[model samples]
Target: MEKASSVLAALFGSREPAEAAATVTSIFVYPIKSCRGISVPQACVTSTGLDLERLQWDRQWLVVNSKGRAYTQRVEPKLALVDIELPMDAFKDNWEPTDLSYMVIKAPDMEALRIPLNKKCAAVDDISVWEWSGSALNEGNEAFEWFTKYLGKPSRLVRFNTELEIRAVDPNYAQGYKTLFTDGFPFLLASQGSLDGLNELLDEPLPINRFRPNILVDGCDPFSEDLWKELKINKLNFHGVKLCARCKVMCLFVDDTGWPWSVLSACKEMSGREVKGCCCREPLRLLAWAMEMASNAAADHGCRQPVSLVLRILPLLGTVPCQCTAPASASAAACAPLSCFIPTINQENGVTGNEPTSTLMKFRSDHALKLKKTQGKMFFGQNLVCKESLLPPRGSKTIAVGDPVFVLQKYSSNVDAPI
Candidate 1:
């Protein structure tokens, strides 16, 4: 196993640095937790790793369960359907974080959830996000009830509390750095060249949104980011921290109302009943076959024959254990790979169950490129931390789309990291 921090040393390999400077192609920010991100023409850069009061514009808000545990698309796949819209037009005056008052959040069948942003607002401390826990402004029961209704669970909204807390970056990677609700670092960066290279190998090409990088630069060879040690986008200086390890969250079926996870759940329920028929009949073989159909319906978008459900009802049936085998690497282990949708059974109960089944819906581009080239870890982007002084003191400084990007470091191989 790899360290909790920079696990790329065993996997990501070396590449030649591009002589040509890169261009800023796109910048995206996700104001709401696990929802769709909006591309910005320009974003105000802020210091994250330091003990700054608060960092804004990134993952400032988060969704917490009853226990205050963070919820992401990994568990709530429909989070992808929640639309997070920024108040760009409100920036007519000063472009500082204070200028923004609220963000509009909308989901399917529900009225928009509006939450105000108060930089000086007090917060509820000890909100858990993996190993590091910190303070966050509890967005109140109205926000909680709205999320609980949509997610079908006791979920609430919390914003990062800059007034009372600062999260440090992993010491293994960098020191004195802090990011909000992000998995690790403050910024995630990728290049157009890498995407083009990946698209060449995939049967279904993915948009840049699928990877969810903070900065998308043009030019450079495929996977050039793997070798970047230091960089400067316009005036902001950054240290390349680590190669990101991607999970199934990157490959989700984004829909108008989150991905139709609920719809698939309904499909499984409806199909399960059709197998049991009107006579309380259960053909042992038909029951087993029907479960397969449900799993398929949950994984694939294509509709299947309802005949599997309506199979001729037979009175003869026996309850049998349904076993789902783990991949060779995780044999007998609990979790499955990103590409798999396996159900686990408890020996004591003979009942089988699983979390919502997920498949590689987007980024069908070659995993061989992302998964193999960077190590079996599948690094899709670069995590960056910037110097505190580099950020604008007040308001916003517009960085045009075609700004020049300079690699501040000289050519060298990484000692702690892999090829």
Candidate 2:
């Protein structure tokens, strides 16, 4: 068995420098837990992190007890399946608008139960919701009644209050930004190759959600992200703070059908149990170091790679164009005009050129490019271009001055790299 210390040392060690800088292929944000996510071609960089302008944390709603402690889905796996909807103008109106959003949890027989919003419906009962840190949040009664009634277990609903800013444990650290209820930090990272490798060893593949990573990267080897201490996706950058240790929670069956011994046995054999409460003993720090080292090693090996990274955006929901003319105008006029750009490598190898104005950007080996309108025009593109295009290899060719390029739609997979 590989000692944990050995793994850590190998991952943290220095290696050959990168020949060329890496670029981001796509970005994704999940507003609600266990539900669909919103994908934006572009986003704004913020001190806390990337802000997609609409996508926010869905699990930000807290289920608390009468004592104000939080409850976790750990005991009730069904909680992982609950769905939430946030108000579009919560940021501007401070939860005062009559159209406050609601949440719904799926019941047996495909039934949907609504959790109410507003002060009038606030006092139903209280329940507890658990955070990743094992802390409990005591939520109101109304939330409790809504959760327990549908879950058939004692539970309650709680909303994340921006006014009640919860800061990270390390204020000076990168993750210290204010947030409601996230695992611990604002981001989570995982690799598709790592998951694929694990599935290869198992009889059946586990769903990616079993790990609950906020950021999923593709095009790299399994477990390569552990080495990335710092990364840039266009104008946005992330400084990885800690390694995410593997816990027993990973072995716990998420389908609510009881624990699966086969999966547990496989995990125990693969990663020896060191931690007590968690299933897997892998430490967050160690994992982070491993990823950083692996990425460096790959770059050193002369393999250009494509990578997909996800970020959470604030203001979970927003208003869209309605049928009414005024509302339509308002919605349409909300965003500034935007355009996508592709940066193609010129024949000179070192030289680069922007795509023709009349040509729509298309997939190419050099790189995928996009241009977002912030204060000025910002470009974003994704392609294997160097070593990272998601698509298979095509012979190297140079673009003529007047060649046409068409911008392709972004991928929707958890890891949205072009294929």
Candidate 3:
């Protein structure tokens, strides 16, 4: 096995040993399987994993049978192609700081459904949703009707309840806590260099979306993220729990419409794994295992283990191959063009990209913002107290209240005001 330090040095260009510490640049969670992700600036680290306003796994909204057993996209490859939208309305009055509102799923046909915020409903017929524990869920009939109508197949919706007490086997040999329905672990990490490397290996470059990772880190060599056991980026810290095992999903091709299986044969040939799996399968597991061993090595070396990596936050520049640090003028220049690229509601000048209704509710409450609909326009307010005209849909438009929205342009407003 390669020495972890040597591997790190090879992955990222030469850096001072002290300067090469691991850090988390971004955190993402998908509340529903094969749907969009909710990206947050910061999250609380827990024993179970990241706590994003009580939402985890990202695939908690599942299709199950009358017996309450769960189903995955693996058996129904079409499930991987669905899209979901969580509108802003679901997060209205009942919003809590910790509550996740709605979830949305998009079908292969591109039709979208916004599930209600409520968890209880009727059960679907003949379809049971099963968790990792092999226990069946009672996803109500209403969910089945909704899914069957949209999916054009017999399916039902199920939610991973905190009450179910599902757990995964921790590598440390401790009992794990209940999870919302992730693939099989607490965290997924991906390296920008690794993706870039793979793109170089392929005839054409693929988007990072194909990997569906929970974390994206820059400044590391290709595949170096697999060697980290604990990493701290700015103020965020990550304790990598286990290796994320890969499956054939990585080789599944998603066309412009996001449908898979078009290039499975090609991927098999490319990976030389006709019966083994896709590229993401063994590679992901190998990376995870390497990180765990690295952490153990660091501990054995008698080095002080730091809690969470500390990172100095930087503004996002909306360009391919984005640099972590950039000038204010550059940042503003990058953001200025976003308004014309996105559709917006004229009232509050808010721009939305197909968010699920329930998750939107949690977003509003956590940020203390109110999203109101007026004459087909969506207006936003700060705690229903101070309402401001919606700004143009610049790249900054995606920044929510609780998020650390950096101002790239200088303004003469109250310098002492809280962000």
Candidate 4:
């Protein structure tokens, strides 16, 4: 017990969220699972969908290997070489409120292929993601044929169940939270300050895309995301569940989760680890109180049930062997063009194919009780779960870059479960 206590003190380094609510730095979506992403000005956040365009959710489409395992950068670094796009009016051109006819894809030697998006109501197929299994809308023969040719391996294309009710988030962190294709949650949050700090530590100043968060924020201390409890941006409320575990996908090369692992571990190891409790109710505010108030406040607020906790605090691309990063510093006038993000890697000199991009970024966070080295080494973005809501709500819940974000509630950490 004494040894465990020592580790916590070193991990919680002497730091706090150095400032209050910050601005949305960037917004990104992996339209196709594991391929590449598109940065958008706005997205409609939903419990079951990414920012909505008509009704399309981020990562609604996916690619499967011969055995039906979902193909991600975990095993296929070449997946990064593929390019996917979702134009602003992507919905207007090929999609309608009722029918999402198709989307077009392009890659090095392959001609642009327009894959249809009409399989949701069709037959279902046995598909597996990680250890979970579910039925998906298989994209039919043409897509299968195309993917097989493009990947040079047997591959199939599948869509999320249009019902948007199949996959569920880990209930331990989020109750009844549903998602599709994502490793778990519907959202991820990273901070600009964290990325800037990471750049200072690396051989090459990396781009934010290296980490792949759903949302990015600016104007906070480096690695401060690890300190967030609850957050609100636009109409959607997001809770930080766990820090995003680093994956090899970040560096676009398959070397066992790469630099991000080192980055997250550094953040996890430097903090003071005493699992202290704070009032952390909505619209997050700091208070001066005595130790006596802890138990009384806990009983009054209760646990397991969520509250409004209003806050005003805080806070991907692809391919061509894509060199994508979340925006470095985004504003209305100077968004980085799509071309700037996709380029060849000049590995020798550590330069990208095009001129240096001003990328904005965020990393995953953890309520990590790092009692050991292996446990401390694998997290980056703040994993997020959408609040319970019906699939396809009556109105859209939108969030985007430049949107205002608030610190809503308390950070959650359970000492009993560290795995």
Candidate number achieving the greatest lDDT relative to the actual structure? 1
For residues 364-385, what per-residue lDDT tens digits would candidate 2 score against the true structure?
1112222121122221111111
- For candidate 4, the clash count comes to 44
Ranking by TM-score: 1, 4, 3, 2
TM-score of every candidate relative to the true structure: 0.63, 0.44, 0.46, 0.62
Each model's number of backbone clashes?
9, 72, 46, 44
Q: Model 3 off-target regions past 4 Å? A: 1-26, 34-57, 65-69, 87-101, 108-111, 118-131, 134-139, 170-178, 233-237, 247-419
Tens-digit lDDT track of model 3 for 1-31: 5697786444332322345433445656666
Which candidate, 1 or 2, has the higher lDDT? 1
Ranked by TM-score, the better of candidates 3 and 4 is 4
Can you give the lDDT of residue 231 in candidate 2? 50
Task: Rank by lDDT, highest first.
Answer: 1, 4, 3, 2
Question: lDDT tens string, model 1, 1-419?
Answer: 44833443222222323554688988788886567777777776643334441224678888987767776654455676788876885322345445357778888899998777543444786587655676788888778899999988898899877666777768788776677877778888889997877666655555676667778998887768867777766655567777665432122323223425543454356454333212111112222222222111111111232223331111111232223322221111121122121111111222222311122223421243343232122356677776543333443334446777777663254333332
Error of 3 at 213 (Å): 0.8
**TM-score winner:** 1
**By summed lDDT, which 10 consecutive residues of candidate 4 come out lowest?**
290-299
